[model samples]
Target: MTSNDIRFDCQHRGDGGPLVIVPRIDGTPLTELVDGFEIAAGMQPAGDAYGGLIPEFFRFGPMQDHFLGRSTNTMGPKTPVLGCECGEWGCWPLMARITATADFVTWDAFEQPHRKARDYVAFGPFQFDRHQYDDALQALSAEIGSNVDDTRA
Candidate 1:
């Protein structure tokens, strides 16, 4: 689908701590989508083997930088778009090549680092409107930040 079909949001794991910010696309959790793709391909989904990145990575600056192709941490040309359910990025990752232009941000070349043989070529090359993409990121960051603040209060 084109950028218009893409959206970004967050899902909080209850009692999973204020720092936990699990990203959701449309209304489904990201891990579920990955699992669905795997299942559709006749391969078992990672299930609990997948999860969100650590809290630090969700912050506006780092996250924005990563998506915008300005971050240094990368696996070759692909970036770790999702991480292990254990909260560590390197353990298990869903990598993608993210590209941003003046008006659109595109994500393609998805790979499951540990399952090199599993093909994700048909999964996604989701293109997102730059404005919507940025707004979603900012909103997620703000929501996360506010949650953290509420927790401390």
Candidate 2:
């Protein structure tokens, strides 16, 4: 796959729990890429924080709009692209500026919320075709949504 090509996969925790929606760019998991960058930079990678967001938080709605560059969270124009392994996004988050246009969507300016000194300037400015990116999001969201067991009374 090209550098711009992005794919979404569900990562089962093998504990009979919820599934996480992981993003793979050019066949490399995003968490690995970030951790590799940290290692190359002589910094300790935040292993516990290197994980994809829970499917519930990644469903198509405000989260999708955030990724599409249509909305922003408390981080201003940046949004949390990944969260902690414990499933608490606010505990540890990898934020990035997502820019979308009619033709393309780009993610850049990555920052670890708890590490202000860490420079992620060399990490990414990964761009993807808008059509493909949107399609991937919708498909993943649908899959997760369908499998959700909402037992609220």
Candidate 3:
């Protein structure tokens, strides 16, 4: 009985709800994620259950691209963290270099690049030149897209 998606990002760029959502920028490397269980004696319990389907994430372990359990798993030695942000503040730091994939948006409410464009349009007319924003947004989006694809792959 999971709830909704909650996301994590080391390079957090905005504040408040409806963030410029993307994929995870970083997370513990697979080796470290697995080792954390060993170090903590499995006290944390892998897998987020507040809501959504992402079960676990690792940089070096089997859960590399996206996260650990995209849908569900056989229930192994998993662990859960307090999430990258809790309340108005971040409960913990978002680990770097691991992007997560999920059934839907498990954490933050997000959309793809085209969705972002729609949101931009909805924000109303741009007093400034659209060219500048267009170029800038495209460049940044490309950078993020590359990283996101790598993480998912």
Candidate 4:
């Protein structure tokens, strides 16, 4: 595929649960998502557990999205630090690029002078904008429709 061509795959649970999107891409491995429903502890019986949105991890690595798995509530403040309770790969400097590209995410910065090394600066956990997410999914769906037509031609 060319640089403009992007392909996506969707996987569904046999039990009729949330669907997962697999974006096959080659890059810096910047972001990954984890919906609130995926968490076993805080899962609600009804509605989208993550407010119909998927939270993204700014950093990249194996299972980085699951770094907050131990926490019952993954919606809390996210500290972009390496080897924290949340996850292993922590990159505070990526905030600029993340916000610039992701219009749906809003950054909330704070201070923590007590911590060692990465003191005095930390941003809140990234949250997904419901409207933007839905819109994005719709766009992807439309792309899939067009792809089907292209193949028939």
Candidate 5:
């Protein structure tokens, strides 16, 4: 199914196991997303466990730069390390999922929880263009295919 067909504003929730993408509309089965949705690390989906996934939201890439430059209302003044790929759980976008609700809260830097907290729960609204995500997915698929071909050669 196309991105438009899927309800984009659903929340990602998990009960200590695999995440379930629930639609805002009641009575909808979360399983609907089985084939329709793809979990993205940022703007791109993660590769298989056998191969390490690449971070696509870095400020270095042209598209990522454009995406990072376009700040959403939720995100306040750009932090010094907004888009750094420091290998730490640095920037948000832990896992990007579209929601059907537009009324959701935006980004707030002050909300980042520390490990010392008794309980930590953090979720951010990922603001990204669907077309851009599709393009990035295609590019990643091509790159993986190219690698396979080189290995065979």
Candidate 6:
């Protein structure tokens, strides 16, 4: 199947797990993502794990800087640490499949869990509520203990 074949329909459950990264595929016995959706030290999906899988709905690149600079509402303030090969297109193309809904300590990624990062913007410790983050972290922790590796997916 193609990347488009994988639906981008992530959700943010306020009272659910700290964080979840589900990769669902249609009509296959192996489609259930629960096993695949293990939590990890960091929110890998939003991190470098999924190759910028979801919308970095936190910043604007060149296209945005020119037009939607003001209305643009992702993470912005600019930093070389949070650099992107995509450049001004820090987040773009409005990818339709990898739908992601995050429950952040704050609406801005530039904040929390981030300040902990040596380079806050490019990459850093993603901070979230302990209760929520722990729950998700536990699941991911289990995965690490397991023999299977979903990162290969």
Q: Which structure among the candidates has the greatest TM-score?
A: 2
Kindly list the per-residue Cα lDDT of model 1 for residues 44-125, writing each as its tens digit.
6556668876656444345667766665666588877778887777888888888999898888899887889999999877
Which prediction has the highest lDDT against the true structure? 2
**Per-model CA lDDT versus the true structure:** 0.72, 0.74, 0.28, 0.29, 0.27, 0.27
TM-score of predicted structure 1: 0.81
**Reference-based TM-score of each model:** 0.81, 0.83, 0.21, 0.23, 0.27, 0.21
Better of 1 and 5 by lDDT: 1
List where candidate 5 sits over 4 angstroms from the true fold.
1-123
Worst 10 residues of 2 by lDDT: 144-153
Once all C-alphas are superposed, what RMSD does model 6 give against the true structure? 17.9
Q: Give the TM-score of candidate 4.
A: 0.23
- Model 6 ranges with Cα > 4 A deviation: 1-128, 148-153
Q: What's model 6's TM-score?
A: 0.21
lDDT of 5 by residue, 65-148 (tens): 222333232233332112112222243222222222233312223122222231112322333235544454355445545544
Clashing pairs in 4: 78-125
Candidate 2, residues 1-153, lDDT tens digits: the string is 243878877765666567776788888888888877887798775454577877455443444675675643445778777777777767778888888888888999998878899999998899999999998878876766665643222
Q: Judge candidate 3 against the unseen true structure and give its global Cα lDDT, from 0 to 1.
A: 0.28
CA RMSD of each candidate after superposition: 2.8, 3.1, 17.6, 15.1, 18.3, 17.9
Off by over 4 Å in 1: 4-7, 11-18, 57-61, 151-153
Candidate 6 lDDT by residue in tens digits, 1-153: 111122112333245311222322342111122113212224333332221112233333322121212324443442221222242223422111111235332112332222243222432222334345334435434543341233334
Better of 3 and 5 by lDDT: 3
- Candidate 4 lDDT by residue in tens digits, 9-100: 43332353333334322321112222221233232221221111112232232122322222223223442212212221231111111131
Q: Which stretches of candidate 4 lie over 4 Å from their true place?
A: 1-126
Give the 10-residue window scoring lowest on summed lDDT in candidate 1.
1-10
